[model samples]
Target: MALLDADARHPITLPDGTLYRDTVYLKNVIDHPRIKVGDFSYYTHSGKPEDTAAILAPYLGHSVRERLVIGKFVQIARGSYFITSSANHPMTGFTTYPFRIFKPETFGYKDLPVRDTVVEHDVWIGHNAAIMPGVRIGTGAIVAAASVVARDVPPYAVVGGNPASLIRMRYSDDIISELLSIAWWDWSLDKIEANLDALTLGDMEALRRA
Candidate 1:
């Protein structure tokens, strides 16, 4: 069966004939008020009827008031949701009721904090993960499936579990620093393809040489 309707607007199909839902579409994302998804990064469906292209922003937990800036080469698996800043209701007060939301003229939306959620390059967000508001996921970090990330993740770290804690670093500090310095993702397509072997398996020295 066809995954998406033939009349689907601005459908993005991969080389393998996989059609990504509307949330991952660059054109649609660029038009979004608070979400900025970079090149080569796309969202997948979780095989639920609620995971439709019609309401991609809500499905991904995006807020119209807060910013969600995702960098290049990010691998975001299916069912990954970003809990944006707008999700947080004012709790410092006696009641959690947001009267300001209803009375824009009297209180305005200034009471709501808008934290920018930043996901750096080459980060791998596994399936069913929920990234909390204001969290900055560093470059090359891996968020394991079903994890609930509530804090900032350092570069090259692997995190998992509820209130996700760092499990381990992907590489030694020196290697990670070197990789960051190289910034391979910024390279041209042809150049990157040429160094694919070194990037995937060989040492940093090999990548540098390439």
Candidate 2:
């Protein structure tokens, strides 16, 4: 039962208006080797494992039993939504309130796809963006705030919109390729912590050259 504070932001506060000198809610969901969840990185529906599984699925959902999968250095912000399994109503009841029935196939229900979501290394997703199932936001990519991403995003691209369209590339393809080659996130935590100052303000090439 050890967990990490997603951030070293402020004095820890529990959900019930009760203040704790040292505690947090993210400790249990964090079990990754390379990724660090900044204190502000949050799950919209923290109470539902099914939802967190879909949102963090890229990092934690694999092993057959677990359904999330995430890569190194992913930065998820508050108000960002990650989806795993979806709730559906029955078929013939489309006009009714109960959403048809549990199993549409029981009445020839069409199966809806369960898509896995992934945010790769060094990726920065802005606040309030909603990433849908089966979407892979690639390494080094940036998704702008309030975007509704519904498909796979390529690496190093900047995307924003209601349904998330690629705005443009943040850097030349060559530079991105070089950064990919450098792979700084794969370095040991000690190395990164030691060079944190340099890594935060500069480019990957600078780190490699250093």
Candidate 3:
């Protein structure tokens, strides 16, 4: 209420030129079995997975373009921006009227396709990172702080910085192959516990020896 009242006092608005207090919008989220929206996460008004993915197609996978994904165990932390889409000016070279009044065909959106936000299992995206449209962050991956992830991140890799690049792989190629071969994360808890000796500390060759 204080910010709204403050905005009313003067013509000054926020840096994004966005006025008013705040609003949240969610839509068409489906098949989320174990997903949890944290208490601090905030969804923007009219944020659509489909619309956002349309702009992100060049940077993502077919799964991301599906527009219907389960945000299984998604953790959209505090103050982060999960933008589904954005509206640009009509580009008349000087057609600056108002942001909303521009025609749909002007700034590119005559054929706006919608996509889904799929944060696969065991993914950890850091605070204030922008998961741009249609990007698919793979399972067990970690996105670092204040990053602009504009591409599909490989499974189990740790990424950071704008147009986020590969700093390094989390495991050796041999270890990665072993983990994928084991694929125990998808197993039931009991099954994992039953095979605890195999899950950790057991070399792939050791399993072969067993």
Candidate 4:
């Protein structure tokens, strides 16, 4: 059972105040059994599996074996979906239809030759974006709204469009290297709180000094 709170309409909050409604919590919509989500990641969904079916449908139907691994501090906007590997049909055969699917003896969907999709820490996937199977989004990268990401995103890159091409890097090579070295997301909570000014104010020098 979910813990009900008097504050929100749905009121079933997660340990980190995620998954609530009426004030930005939608705990009801995160019902997928196969997705492995990291801590402090937020999902904005209506609490329905079908509503976010691109990620869950193949798994629910037992058609995919690949997992969607999300890292901590990732921000997933509403309507974002993951296209699993099982959605791929054998193209080497004469027909696109899966003849194996009809046979009870071979009814299981074969695993594709694709790695599991992974969203690394501190990534921000924008609203309604589609992350294709086997894609790896690196840390601190941003996927623009409605983009379709089919390729791997490098760290701190901003990507957009149907194929999700890179628009720009968040920082110069020197700054990126320094920032990656710092890895603020991995810092302790007390340290993070102490350096809130540097984080919020974009004080790179202060962060470097820390």
Candidate 5:
């Protein structure tokens, strides 16, 4: 039997064996031009599956310059959202108020700088976390519940709190580097399944041999 189905829209099954409709595979649910989600990345929410894109990144419009790139195996909890560069108001002027957006013809801050928001592979974002514009969350990072992430999160680090400070590193620098080199998330599903014990057990020797 397969461990998981990447194509399944509602991937989670409750203990009672009923499909958990609140959780959806982001790639299967989202069709936004500005958003890119890798296979097996899922987000939990109570809204309709079709509204996944809007709910995940509310400010990312079709015509917006910025992009939201999420990598494989990302687990996003409920109420977590990305505030992309498109949501930023013009800060070059004296006042931050968006006067041009009032009119349809000049309804944007086209001159403002924009940057893509990137969440790398194997990242686990906890509930109610808000990722600020253009923040690059590194691979294997953990964002704790209710965090207001305003800066980049290093790989394998556990971050929490309002400004999302690093709580601790999951592994030493060498181990993190080795894991990055291994890049288990890029492995084929069969290989990943075959090596599940090493991954789950945190046996570096076994993983290295695999």
Candidate 6:
């Protein structure tokens, strides 16, 4: 059997052979029009599989202008959720109160500028993290547990806190550039499996060779 199955909704299996229902491949489970998820991107949540999209991104409604773009191999821990553009109240007005929402006919703040929320490949978002609207979390970034990320996180950075700040970069700029150029995440599963040592170990030479 293959190590990974993209088609499986419940992808993880315990040592005793029971399917781990809490984790699901986001692409397979999510059917929202405004959200785009790549292969192997998984989210751990207690909600039903059918409600995975809503659970992960509660504010991203079907007709919303903004999008939630998540790339391949993203690891989203339990209790993490996205606050998309639709959730924002009108900040331009004198007050933040959404008076238009009281009436169904005039229920939208369409004039507000909307921006898409993007999470790039191989990003790890920890438990109870809140990703703010329009934030772009770069590839290989690590968002610490219980963080409220209001700003963009650079690639390979470790960020944490209420308004998440950069803790440190995982690698030097040169190495990060090299890895981004390599883009191992784009490789086929067979190729990736063959170069597991290079991927798991910090072996740049081996990775280049692979």
For residues 100-124, could you state the per-residue lDDT of candidate 5 as single tens digits? Answer: 8889999768888888999999999
On the 0 to 100 scale, the lDDT of residue 53 in model 5 is 92
Number of the candidate with higher TM-score, 2 or 3: 2
User: Which candidate order results from sorting by lDDT in descending order?
Assistant: 6, 5, 1, 4, 2, 3
Q: Write the per-residue lDDT of candidate 6 for residues 38-116, one digit (tens) a residue.
A: 9999999999999999999998889989999999999999999999999999988699999998998888788889999
What is candidate 3's lDDT per residue for 80-185, written digit by digit as tens? 5544433322445476454453565453343346555566655667777877766787765788878888888887799999988877777777776766666655
Cα lDDT computed for each candidate against the true fold: 0.73, 0.60, 0.51, 0.72, 0.95, 0.95
Better candidate number, 1 or 2, judged by lDDT: 1
Tell me the lDDT of candidate 3.
Answer: 0.51
Ten-residue region with minimum lDDT total, candidate 6: 104-113
Give the worst 10-residue stretch by lDDT in candidate 4.
1-10
Q: Pick the candidate with the highest TM-score.
A: 6
Task: After superposing candidate 2 on the true structure, give the runs of residues whose Cα lies further than 4 Å from its correct spot.
Answer: 1-27, 30-66, 85-111
- Estimate TM-scores for all models: 0.79, 0.63, 0.50, 0.78, 0.98, 0.98
- Where does model 4 exceed 4 Å of error? 1-34, 48-64
Task: Identify the leading candidate in terms of lDDT.
Answer: 6
| Global fold similarity of model 5 (TM-score) | 0.98
Give the per-residue Cα lDDT of candidate 5 at 172: 98
Cα displacement (Å) at residue 85, model 6: 0.7
For candidate 5, give the lDDT of residue 41.
96
